[model samples]
Target chain A: MLELHQISKHYQPGGQLIEALKPISLTIKAGEYLAITGTSGSGKSTLMNILGLLDLPSRGDYLLDGVAISSMNDQQLSQIRSEKIGFVFQSFHLLNHKTALENVMLPQTFGTVPLSDIRQRATHLLQQVGLAERIQHKPAELSGGQRQRVAIARALMNQPKVLLADEPTGNLDSQTTLEVMALLEALNQQGQTLILVTHEPEIARRARRCLVLRDGEVVSDHLQRCTDPTQF
Target chain B: MTAQAKFYYLHNHLRSCLNELRSHALRSMLTTLGIVIAVAGVISIVAITEGMNHSLVKNFSQLGTETMMVRQNIFKAMNNDVLQPMTEREWFALQNLQTGISAVAAFSRVELPGTGVSGVRISYAGRSQIGRLLATSANLPQMTGRYPIDGRYFADSDSDARRRVCLVSEELAATLNLQLGANKPLLQIGNFQLQVIGIMPGGNRDILGTSADVYLPLGFAMQLNPKDIALEFGFRSLDESNTEHIKRQVNQLLRQIQGTRPNETANFVIENATELKQFQTDTLGTIRTVLLLVIAISLIVGCIGIMNVMLASVSERTREIGLLRAIGASQSYIQSLVLTEAAILTTVGALAGILLGLGIATIIAAGIPQIEQVILPPAAVVLTVCCAILVGIACGALPARKAALLSPITALNLE
Candidate 1:
């Protein structure tokens, strides 16, 4: 349910032109899991930022659910981000001062949901991610795996249609990484669209389809089926 | 937004800040130091002014509500320090005037040494108490707005017939160990027996402090002390209006009677209670101005301190503001949040200062006997609160603007 038509993004530093994303075109249907794999400086992160509506394209048309978002103001873009897209960062960007439950409830603040219901839903999501006992613990008190779980629960708080995880398990150990992958796979199997950016081949193999990007352009788009999606 | 929602938001934000403040209680107290000092200074000055105003009103009221004084003045051509005396003819002319003249009386002094005139004896209580006897007309009670409480005063016939009747003050009676009442026997002063009519209550004993006074008939005083050339005349007017006119006319008539030129300076001066009241008002005004200046300086210092603290707080909360914005908080929300914190701090400080100031004033007023009571003027209280609110808004402006202008991405990048 996302489309990008000839999107081009550039940056200038010290009067030198630097291309972050070259002209590119892509489309993803509803309820499909996709992976954008690339090395450092390959523009995958920049594409993810543009896809999430966190940044605007220098020149392009971004149609999200069939509405052109390039003409939307910052406020309208933010509203769409809050209502339609959930983001999971590699660093797990949970507010250091807030408990796991509060971090998960952060996105719900923009909606009309009652605080008590938000708390209950956040508690339930944390329990689903095997963090029921650690829901009240702040990020500083949690392990690497537990912090990522809190981020994942937070990304699902508003029940967004698309879950965008930018290297969600990049900082976790292999076993914790497998658990995070399994959690994401289970959500995707339930018909929620998932898009992840990663450089790890084994991690990329877990997605239903993998798209390789290099030098600010997509080099390949291939479909993959793992022997066991729950294992690394 | 609904009021309840707004209240919930504000309450949570304030509670969070308060918890932080409680964690650093000593620092918070230090931050509030400027506010406390300013409030205390304001209170003290206001209290002093209130106390002075109270005392002034009391003294004036004691002088009587509808009392005015009239006296003769000599015309001065170049020098203003000339003194002049009024003649008997001029005094009679004033007494006959139909304008605001209430009662007219002339005064002369006499000294009597040793022994009692009637039943009351004479004794010296202090140096000034001895050889100070006032000889005035029988209408002295009406002119001075004072009357005997225990014994009779001299009658008009006593002055007309030049009788040697006299009245003694409570201090003189007490010194002689005599009881003074309406039926009490006449007091003896210098071999003259004067009947005791009444006793006058001494209101401010320290100011009109001593009570050792004696009153006698003016004509009898003239007869007893013929060579005493220093004679002072007093005129009591009906009210405040005709006092100036009566004074001018009396001065002119006195100049004509004494055969002095209009341009020539008089040898006597005219004085009144009005001059004393004016002096009191000027003194009060000067004191109020000085106090207001001090309060203003303190308030400025307090405002500066508030601004400094708010700026520091804004800088510290930059990342938190960014996080809120990233989570969908509007820019106005961030601005309002910072402004709310500022308003809360300043309002609390100001309220604390007002209470502190009033407390100090009450304590000082309680300790001083002359003050009677200390009252805060409504206008002063209103002004103080308004100044405090304005200071809060002014101090919050820069920090609030900075918070509102911060970009969400840049703010999130703040470490």
Candidate 2:
């Protein structure tokens, strides 16, 4: 579960304040599948950054399970990032020097997780993501679709409650995109909190609910019908 | 808190370091060269100096830790300079039941008659040779704490009755071609016949197989070569540690007995091999310090080179650092990654250098016959290695700090 109370972001260019996001409040309960769609300057990234606890909101507070995120220190924020929140980047941000299994096991290396259990857990996660046969392949060796699957497995390393995806299929071809979207759809249906930020309308329609942002504010927040957009 | 957990963390970080090192092996080796030279220099210097110290200490101790030789400044006495040897009255008090002194003997040397610098000549049957005569008291060997090699030393009766007896070094006996083991072989020295009572052991191995100087009773020697000279008093202490105390006491006695002014240096000089060894040690210490200074400077320069390489490595991996931070690694963890990598590099260099240094030291020791043995003290080796690692850690600190402060947002915003 997550809550944003009057959260906004702004950047200072020399002397004047440039508003990247206007004040807004929102909440998403556990297991909610939501998509945030916006143009380039629609504050989608700004909002996602606030939601993921990567960047602090300029004003007001962000709450995750009734706890204020802005009040905690950097170390605690990192702990939450590792434990409760999983991020899927558009670039599939897998370290090139590591194998598929090693990338999946990266998160636990920072914590008190025992080394003996890391391999087994990572292997199971890789298998769950349908990457059982390619667990040893590095990012350079993997196909676009397989690399995205590995990224998804890595995000789930700590069994994060909320999956934050920023344009998760932006770099993939149409075929790879369909497979990745299906995987995310199946995960959301299984009650994983999936918040996807994207620009594609058809991709956004796959979620149970969709929100469209114009300028820096959310303009639409409604349930997506199966016929809302033509399926790929 | 648990041993397993601590071991796991150590293993993880060390492996990470090794992995990173493997990725940049050439750079690591280049960076490691400095520490290598430093360790090698230190090890070789320590080994050589320690070896020299070992031999010198043995030589000085062999002179008998308890023995003290008092004479007119022997070096100055040779140059016909100042100071005169003890008189009968002065020698009487020292030899008569002195507290710290176990035994006292007076010895002196004089030119052989008509031989000049060719040295004292002696004959035995058909054999004849030139050698120096060491005129000493009957208890000379006992006072000096070195017994004769084959036969008995001159007895007190030999000195009292002024009997003609001699102790020849093994080399001298060989040169004389006389079977000393036979019934009292006689050696004719300066128109008088002397029985070879003892054969002194072969000392000064460089000249061991050749003829050496012969020892004779002081009274007999005085009668045979009557050249007026001073008496050189040699005494042994009851215990080894009492040499210095006894020497100090003897100095006061000599000053009083010779009736010298308090402002004047003693007419007699006390010669102790330990003192010479100590002086040599002090001089060696200074040389060692200078050598260490050179070693330290080299190590620092090498450390700087390593630091420079680490800084370059940190900047090169800025993007990876940001990604690591984003993934959940703390600033401290990121710092350790850089520091550990640097540490691993220098530690490897140090080990290589130690091996190199030991090899060089062993080769050097083999080349020098005077060095009895060369060994690297274990404590010194351990300390050298530890110092190298600490230097590596110090060099890594700034780069690690710079890396740790990198912001995670840079992963996306900056290449």
Candidate 3:
């Protein structure tokens, strides 16, 4: 479970204080698939960064599995992020020089996993992302969809508690986007908690819960049933 | 992680460092050039220094280790108000000393009557050459460990009888086209004709050097120049083990004869073969230190080059740093990774430098026949490698710190 009690974020650029995210309360139970939808300057990216533990909230407390994230030191925060959060970025962010399997094993390189088990788990995750045969292929050699799958495999390498996808298909073709979305849906159906941030309403509608934001304020928070039965 | 696991990760860090270099081969090679030159210079200098030391020891062994030279301390006499010259009186005092010496001889550089040039002119068989004239006693053969390769050395009878017999070096004999033994020719030395009795060994490689081309009986030469008072004394100890005792006894006798008071320093100096070798070794050590200083400067320049390249690498790989951080890498891990890259760069350079240095040393040794062997001192090699690695680590600190302190979000957002 994740809880954000009136969490807000602001930044100062050349003396002007701009609020990137307003104080907004939110909660999501385990295995919940939530999508945050917003247009440009809508603070969705800021909220996703805060949720991923990449940025700290300026006001309010964030609790993940009953541990206060705001009071933790940088090292402790990194440990929590490594163990509890996995991120799929718009750019994939896979090391281009590394093979798909190496990219997947990157997360565990800094963890306590034994060397032999690291390779085994990375291979299994890569296979689950439908990249079994392409494990040795580098990022440049793989298609956009394959690279994103490698990123997803890497994010799941440590068996993180929550998966955060921020416009994960932004650089992919529509066909590849559908494939990635279906993979996400499948993972969600398997009781994996997923958080997706996208401006596309169609993409947002596929999630079990939708939260829309405008001008740094949350405009709507509701649960929805997907129209596509295949993605259920 | 456990200690063993951390060690394994260090291996991974080195592997990644090497991989990074492999990807940017040209840049890495350029960055390491300074280190290569510095290590090569260091190695070659040490090799040559070792070779010279080996040669010095060999030359000392070839000469008599028991031989000791007694002469006026020129630097000390210069500072004193009255310059005390070592004359025959001091020589007589040394001869009467109770130390166990094998032979005692007095020598001086004699100037011919009309030849004022430093060396005396000698003509034999119509070939004329300038020869250095040495006036030494019959004990010269025992003191120098050098005997005539072709005739007999002067005898005490020759000195007692005041005969004008002289010895010519084998080098001068060959140049003058003179035959030795029964039909030996006489050398002309400034209005006096002396019979050449012996031909000593030639070649300047001797410890005392083959600078003296001609030698005459000391008493006979002194009688010819009775006014020349600055004479040097030399003696051979009974054995190599007795040389130090003989030196001390001789020093005490000379100080007493010269009337040097109890608190005053000795005006004369007594030198044995060991002290001479140590002086040469110390001079070589000074040269080695100077050479190492130059190489150290080059190493510092190399370090700066490595630092510059690492900074560029950090800047170029900002996003990579963020990605690693996001995955789970600690800041210390990132710092160590960058440092490993620099270390690998310098290590490669040092290895290449060692090969090049040995090659250069071998070439130099081959060119110079005096150098007995090309020596690769293990300590110097180890020191060079250590120096290079330390330079890498020193230069990597700033750039590594810069990379480690970068915000992961800001770094990941860089396009």
Which docking class does model 2 fall in?
acceptable
Model with the higher DockQ, candidate 1 or 3: 3
Model 1 chain B scores worst on lDDT over the 10 consecutive residues at B203-212
For lDDT, the strongest prediction is 3
Model 3, A1-232: lDDT tens per residue? 8999999999999999999999999998999999988887999999998998888999999999789999887788888888988989999998887889888988877655566788899899999999899999999999999999999998998788999999988999999999999998899999889999998778888888988889899988877743432321
Model 2: per-residue Cα lDDT over A1-232, one tens digit each: 7988898899898989988888888889999999988788899988988788778888978889778888888778887887888889898888788899988988877665577798899999999989999999989999999999999998888988999999999999999999999998888888899999998887787777887787888777877633344321
TM-score of structure candidate 3:
0.69
Q: For residues A115-140, could you state the per-residue lDDT of candidate 1 as single tens digits?
A: 67878999999998899999889899
lDDT of each: 0.71, 0.79, 0.82
* Candidates ranked, most accurate by DockQ first: 2, 3, 1
Give candidate 2 regions above 4 Å deviation: A225-232, B1-10, B64-275
TM-scores for every predicted model: 0.63, 0.68, 0.69
List residue ranges in candidate 3 displaced over 4 A: A225-232, B1-4, B61-279
Query: Which lDDT value does model 2 have at B128?
Result: 85
Could you arrange the candidates by TM-score from highest to lowest? 3, 2, 1
Candidate topping TM-score: 3
Q: How many steric overlaps are in each model, in order?
A: 21, 0, 0
